[model samples]
Target: MAKTLEFAYETPQEVKVGDDETTFTLVCKNEGLPVDLTTAKLITVKIGSRDGYLREQPISIDSLSKLPTGQFKFNFDKDTLDNFPTGSYFLEVWVADDQGTSIYPSGNPLNFIVTANIENSSGATITTIAYDDFVKELNKAASTIVKGDKGDKGDKGDKGDKGDKGDTGATGIQGPKGDKGDKGDTGTTGPQGPQGATGPTGPKADKGDKGDTGTVDNAGLISAPAFHSLQTQVNNSAVGTNLITNSNFSSGLDHWKVNPGANSDCKAVVTTDSDGDTCIHITGTGDACGLYFGPVSFNQNQVTTASVLAKGIGTIWWIGLQSRPFSNFGTISTESYSKIGSIMQADSSSDTFCVYFNPVNNVVDIYIKFAKLELGSHATDWCPNSAEILTQSDYAKIKAAIVALGGSLS
Candidate 1:
């Protein structure tokens, strides 16, 4: 396939692992001339190893230089280097504009080398201690010191300044021909007074008649009917209700079946993505092939929905139903994990669900994750089967609750 943009870099150079000062420069070109990057919305470098995409770092638009030539410079900082061991790596520069995203140097990914750091290769042994441990050791050493003589007391602090005096009150209302009396000094507290004699006790009254006894229903225990109802509700909860077994493919291909056409090179396997997330990686060329889910059950006119995160192009289809030949989600192509879904009302025909890729005769490369199938018309987030999520202890507690409520598990 022809790429819209081209990227040329300084002659392939090797950088020592952990070398932060070294920089790598790439010049983006349209046709053979340098492209003006000022108008571009985003420029990013996707770094990866032979395994897959590891990380992406954005290049600031201000950093684009057009002086002698248009280019951007980046370095292998600690964070990016930490994800890489001493080995070969590749990167692709992505340039985006109002048109769309364009990947550069489409021929082959730009390659670079990472060699082992000198310190690592030297095999030097360095001993280190935790700060807390070092502090403890210093305290242990200080314990052997002799006691010092007591110091003399410090001088007392000076007295604080006195507060200002209050203003005199206004003259009292004029009295009617009366002279004012002198104020008397405060009197001393008086002695405690003697206790008074107790009064005579009152006569007791007769007790009232006892009340009637109340009826006890079930002795305050849970009734069998209520317990059964609770048991039914607990069973109906979403816990063990996901219809797609091996939804995440974390269990390899336990519940999945491969349907490869004659002479088809298609196959699916469980693999981890760049972020260490589990997904199904499907790759093949030539004839069409697919990954199928079930001849599982479904009811007439029941709304069933299925969804899966995918990259590349493919279609999810429902077969073995009364709906003509089959029903399928519209064709979808994506460069990243995108959720694709299909909704259908079932007929009594069959319940087989298949995800078709590579169709007829074409190349197929895609990834799938977190597939889900449920009864609602709307697709929901992926969830594992109850056996994968419910722990034995949790189930035990639930069982005990049911038993205590006078219910029995079938």
Candidate 2:
């Protein structure tokens, strides 16, 4: 195929030695269209000089979705840049796809400079001499010293007289404490007076008559029909909202399928939660017990959030044709229901997406409820399927409304 891959990166790409957390954001296209990065098995950025190679760093798998559309980031840590010296280097993005390996820029590679840090560049040039040369110079200096240096020991002079010794100093004493003062006298107490006489009691009053009971009006309260109407409205609103089919497993794994790779010991069953609500219980021992709901339709570059009311630890993954965005909820309480979710953006080829559930380990027991996969960056309240939300009364009300509006029904 002709050269179709094009790469563009942000500028100010200079880096300092010993620096960490350096990043390069790159946007790629193929034939003037955004390239799907998730399709590649591996993507790496190689840094090298004209002489040879320096270092190569791969993009982190988890953070790929955190970037904007058609963009990928290559992060360099302290260890990678610490080895680089002050010099100019060339970098190329290498992608390994199903077709073959390809490098970006179809022409010359991009240039990036690694400047010297203060700790590495402050000293001047240092010179070193050979050991044999130092030995030869030492021998020549030793030969120049003569044996006539022993005649200076003949002149000894007399010493001067000593002075008189000084007297010893006396010790000092601490001062005495002052005397305490006398205390003052207390005041006298006052005399007590005589008590007054008590007054006479009044007559008792009569009790009043009992009041009548108030009546309760049950007509204004929500009846079975009214409740069914409200519930139908809620479910109808959420009919086509959730991307995943049978997300809550209310139909006992009707639309979910067990992963073929999961261990044979894994088991899934319809169970009830502590609150008497329906849920799916998955359990296994010694291997991954996984299930998935797939082929969920999504728009290009659409952002979606997936959530689950769960008890016990597990990993939730939003699997797309070219991207996998996942989050682990380890702090889920076994004693009560806990909500866990993850937000991800779909790639250009993201029409096919899947919601995958994997237990933290093979030896597992988990209760799952309200499994929701919906469009938008945040999760909303959970609702049942449209078919399951309506009761017989709800259908009757809909027919009545249609009839009153002069609409015909079969």
Candidate 3:
């Protein structure tokens, strides 16, 4: 089996979902004559579920070029890699160098899996698998059940007879009787004992002597701190409290800008809501279009909750943080007034913590409002901005207020 065309994945035995690209390095192993460029026909790399490998040769690659060091590189697109589902996959490399093309092994097919990135949760939902994946799994499992040699027949054993009943044992003293059972349910009163002759009227008893007034003395005691029970006030102001600038779109599209790839047709404008609210409306015709607000101060490695309210036409739009699309919460379908959100690990690859949107298509207008990006793994209520909430003066004011009120908060 000259199936010995050696190749190795850059990250052996594992591939992540969101990786921009993955590569397989092919080391020339064909010892055939005329090893130079002219005789080197092509080296193909084909992948299939481990099950599919049992039935076919590798798919043909259009061509393979050699590096100065005689190593050929195979690059796989991760964006579209999701076309294959989660599970093991078999990667086969066959060379048609001057020697000859590789042939199948008589016993087992050569294969391995490009496993789902179980540890990298950022790309949790990308999916693809063979049409008969379940069936293949079942067959693969069944074929692994090799039977062991049979055990020697066991020796027969003898039986024993039953014993006779034993004599009764002597009685022990009885326990004290249990408390008498509750009085039996009362019997109905007998018909007013046949009206006995009326008894003479008894004289009314004299009023009892007045009872003495009772008195008790109270003593000192420790008491728990009294809770004021003041209700937490709601901050209904949507002017400027949010960490995101122009998040409410009240400043129109001031803080928002087009990402690098936007064309002139892909532009944003402030539009009035059908219910009379203001929002940033994006419309255009391009393979991709987007609006982003960011470069805000935030640290990656910490998880955060990001969200936005979107309404308009189209199957879906992206929502989440982005540092050059390095991370996304996935897509949200804008079939209605969708309030989309996700919790993500801040992608530290870039410092930009952006609220981004990319419509599925540009045929219709897309409306977005209240884009919020904040630290923490869970979303809190939409607390709008209030007077430069992050300023030193405001911070001091807030701390002073808390301290003045005798709050224990640090």
Q: What TM-score goes with each of the models?
A: 0.36, 0.36, 0.34
In model 1, which runs have C-alpha deviations exceeding 4 angstroms?
A: 1-241, 286-288, 298-300, 313-334, 359-361, 391-410
Q: Return whichever of 1 and 2 wins on lDDT.
A: 1
Choose 2 or 3, whichever is better by TM-score: 2
| Candidate 2 residue runs with Cα over 4 Å from true position | 1-240, 260-262, 286-288, 313-323, 326-330, 348-362, 385-410
Better model by lDDT: candidate 1 vs candidate 3: 1
Q: Backbone collision count in every prediction?
A: 0, 1, 11
Estimate the lDDT of model 3.
0.48
Residues 1-410 of candidate 2: C-alpha lDDT, one tens digit per residue:
11222223222355777677666566554432356777678888887876878778886545677665556876577877777776556667787989988776444455455766656543544333455655554454445443332222333334434444443344344345556545434444433333333333344344344445433334323332444455445544533366666777767788777643255666667888768888877676523454666566644444555667777654333232325332222234667776665544555655443434444433467677787766644456786545566798998999999999999766
Residue-level lDDT of model 1, residues 175-253, one tens digit each, is: 4665767654555544544444444444444444444544333422233333444544444354225676787887888
The candidate, 1 or 3, that scores higher on TM-score is 1
TM-score for predicted model 1 compared with the true structure: 0.36
